[model samples]
Target: MDLLRKSIERVTPLTNEEWKLIVEKSKRIQLKKGEFLQTQHSFVVYECFVLTGSFKTYIMGENGTETVIFFTFGNEWICDLNAFYHKKQASYNIRALEDSELVVVTKPAKDVLFSKIPKLVNFHIHMIEKANIVLQQRVLDLMNKTSKERYVDFIEKNSGRLQKVNNKNLSSYLGISQEFLSKIKREGEVYNEKAR
Candidate 1:
């Protein structure tokens, strides 16, 4: 729990009592590659912090196409905010990209946490603010950026996590087709290699 303690300490220090309360409903779970953390119909009963490995959050279309929304690696939070905050079923899926470990907190426990640790509320606000900024940027990118530009942005942000994601999901996240992503990626890699 030291990692979680450190993550929480970024906003405020936690007392032994406070830490115990926060982790009361938390449990460590493992997900194998391709395992579903939350499916579209699953109840958003918990939110998790990634301890190891990665996951992709996405939605499936009517024709069975998957549109990836985002990826979360170690030290990141993964939750369906819409469903989690509203206490409803998930609208998308969170699937493990590789074997991953997570610390999950049940909604009931989190709902009660705010009252006991007000500092945690501030921490939550910071987390939401950061997540909101990323989401906003994604929307703007989809509206104003070209596919290659988006791919570049993705590389800048994702860095070490790219090799863990397959071409299909990466292209879906970039709002481009697999072939187009491959072309740009090849070109971008060559350009980077030449610069080096």
Candidate 2:
């Protein structure tokens, strides 16, 4: 709950009264590894905050492959906002990579909270805008960057997350094969050794 407050406070400060309203409207859930928070083609009514643990959001491809979209860690937010607000089904799946603790607010509760605390609407907009910008950048990177370039950028942005994900998912995220990812790691090590 503290993390949720901190995440929101980063965008807009919450009054204690408003915080109480938020807490009252939210519910906590614990998910075990391999459990899903939301499955594809399902309605996503809850927008969740990660109190602890790791999760991944992915879509299953036409050819029956899972394309890892993004990973979430502690103190982060995860939700299919478009699907939730537009009253449509989720296009992707959200699953716990490990045991997770999450605080979730239902759409109706969020609406109530937003009406009560107008600043919360701005905070939501800010988060969506921030995600949109990053999403645009990711699309461009996927279209234009080399696998190694993507890997490098991914490492730069998600250093702590690397160890948490398996090679298959990591490679998929970088749009590379596992063998190629291994080759890149070997090359990186050699390059580092030579630089030393």
Q: Which candidate leads the pack in TM-score?
A: 2
Where in model 1 is the C-alpha error above 4 Å? none
When summed lDDT is taken over every stretch of 10 residues in candidate 2, the lowest stretch is 39-48
When superposed on Cα atoms, how far off is each prediction in RMSD? 1.4, 1.2
| Candidate 1 lDDT, 1-196, residue by residue in tens | 6888899898888899999887786899999999999998788546889999999999999899899999999998888887888888898899999999999987777878988787888899988998999899989999999999888888888788879989998989988889998899799889989999
Per-prediction TM-score: 0.94, 0.95
* Tens digits of lDDT, candidate 2, 159-193: 97777788898898888889999999899999989
Error of 1 at 136 (Å): 0.5
